[model samples]
Target: MVALTDEEKAMRDGRDGDAVAAAMDLLIRYADALGAEQLCETRNVAGTNTQPSPAKTKLFEEGGWSKAFSVISLDCDDDIEVPQMKVPTCQLQHGFGNDALGIMPYSERNIELQAGAESFYSSKGVNVLATCTPYQVGNLPTYGEHIAWMESSAVVYANSVLGARTNCEGGASTGSASITGRIPCWGNHLVENRYGTHLIESGLRMTGFQDWGMFGYFVGDMVQEARPVMIGDLGQPDLADLKHFGAAAASSGGVEMYHIPGRTPDAPTLEAAFGGAAPPESLHYGEAERRAIYDSLNSIGNSEDVDFVLIGCPHASLEQIGRVARALEGRTLSAGTELWVMTPRALRAVSDRNGWTATIERAGGRVLTDSCPAMSRVAPAGTKVFATDSAKQAHYLPAILGIEAWFGTTEECVEAAVTGRWRGSLAPAAVVR
Candidate 1:
């Protein structure tokens, strides 16, 4: 272990007499676990969980733990009422939806308790924003810049995709890091730690959005914890596919970094991504791995009748939303089904300004904002079946919310919403070329 300076020792020993000392100690240890060399000042903090849960809000207010750090800005997937403000109204900059999965699993009373606890942060200048893509909100730190982030996909994307440095911090650690302006320079912060440890070889058979997504899940499961660089006859993937892959990777294996042979910014080639050093071992994925991934994560349709048809795991971009609206021209969601298209709040405004919102609403789908079903604490209750195009949601919803959920392509969900039942099987996306 490296020796700590007197000030660092004092910080660990509660020398400042601030309630944040214990939390800092925990962070330091966590950093050590990741084999970090030092600490770095952090900027831009983001969180996960639909809204503030009681466990999170309480630790911040009643636990004597809240005052430990001075975070400059905060963003998250849920919104909460803020109390007497001291810190600048935090930009509830980005968040996720509770509907992506169905609804939050907790009770309303518990949510109320969490809200009461979170009131303290507002008193210190926290804003309630329900968003998932904080990077879309200008909170992004540049490559090699340190940040305290709690969102799993964002942490992975930033570290592995953008070349920024951060660990998948918890809410409390994130809060304390922002307050202290310092985080253990561990994990993704160090260049040596970012090297690829595993090699993934895939044949070109896996194509289409769903195929690419399952490929990510397959790789995550095969490698377990090793950072892998993908190599093969793999074709190019777009942002939507990458976001889906990243979310699935985060869900399946808790991967902090990945190198895409030609896709990711940092990994223009396999050799470059691997740093000319050989991987510890190589793993190959063919049709068998692909089929296994689908079998493990695919959600079965519930009773051949669908109650809710949802889309937007990473928040559909304008073009995606437009594609749906055009296909849905003069069409309406079946009277029996409640169809909702979810997107980021700002993007919602953009859709409205561009008239896409009216077109979608006119098609019997509401363009909702602020939170997703997986991020929100509530949605229509007792829905027997839920449908989504996101494998990430399909993989986690059953355990997190205890509902019968199914995975499908965006078109399948749209058709289900249109007829109140699934009509078609998964189809490949038409070659965009």
Candidate 2:
């Protein structure tokens, strides 16, 4: 049984309102299920409460957003009035919105439903960041701060890159945490659980976005769900590089955390990554490993006729969007090809203000926000072979949509969108030891 504090008991015994009590009840059950001895305090939560689905629609019709949130988010059957979040909570990416109308196959009714959910949740103090990357849009949790976050890529980034503590929580757990500010103090919440389980080294220097992703895929395939500490002369990785790396790792091997000896916040040295213990025999990311990972990610593709190109997976940063715009500045997409740069609405606004959106639009590409083709399960009318710069998107879009995927660099993907052909190949760097 999980032990509860005085305040926890008060919430469980209905000292708080019905919604808060329901939230507390859900957290207790979740903690107990995880065999957690206690719950930790958290001030940050990232979850999805605005996504529209058939089940959520039915609940909404039955008792409005309150009923939907109570059942789906709080896991409660009671007709409870959802309250303002007790802690800071942000909504993750949801389904397509009005911006997607006529662009794809998403229905208007679902869009309306999602709009309603956004309005309702926003009124209840939910900061709708509406992207998988809450860190980019300023919902960044402080280092060592306990948080309740979902999205595997974000979880890994928080645990590995940002030095924050979080496990892979579900919508229910995050919703409950938002109201109660408590999460099960197990798994990644405890310091001992954050140590490296596998040691890895990369021989080829990684400076490009896709290089980090390929390296990540190799690591994840090797270590699976275990934490890995990477040590090598791999070149400096930027924000977007780590973003692709983490997302690809999560997609390929369900990696929730990793450490780069001197780069990441928590692991300042190789020894610290392993919690000061003797490090394990380091696995090498060499020529064979890089080739196999790249080929595996591109295995689903046989045709070269590209129809769609997706630029972002964890949502494109402002710099990525600008790069795409610059690449497409004076060019036009192929008559049959379409390209979309998925990003947060906040970044989209910035892109618009910076004229990047106009540049891409003039070149016949789009700067889209909030959702991606994979999340919405809708591409251009007849997309058979698609390409993406993101390894995570390349890994999943094939299985999710039954479409062929081409894994390539951002410039290559943009070139495909313009010429309607797949010319991307593994660079010579993949073979050099």
Q: Could you give me the TM-score of model 2 versus the true structure? A: 0.98
lDDT of 2: 0.91
Error of 1 at 401 (Å): 2.3
Error of 2 at 300 (Å): 0.7
Largest TM-score belongs to which candidate?
2
Q: Rate the local accuracy (lDDT) of all candidates.
A: 0.64, 0.91
Model 2 weakest lDDT span, ten residues long: 424-433
In model 2, the clashing pairs are none
Candidate 2 segments whose C-alpha is farther than 4 A from its true place: 430-433
Model 1 lDDT tens row, 112-229:
5445534545555555555555565455568777777776777777877777887887755665554455667777777777878888877644466677777778777777666878
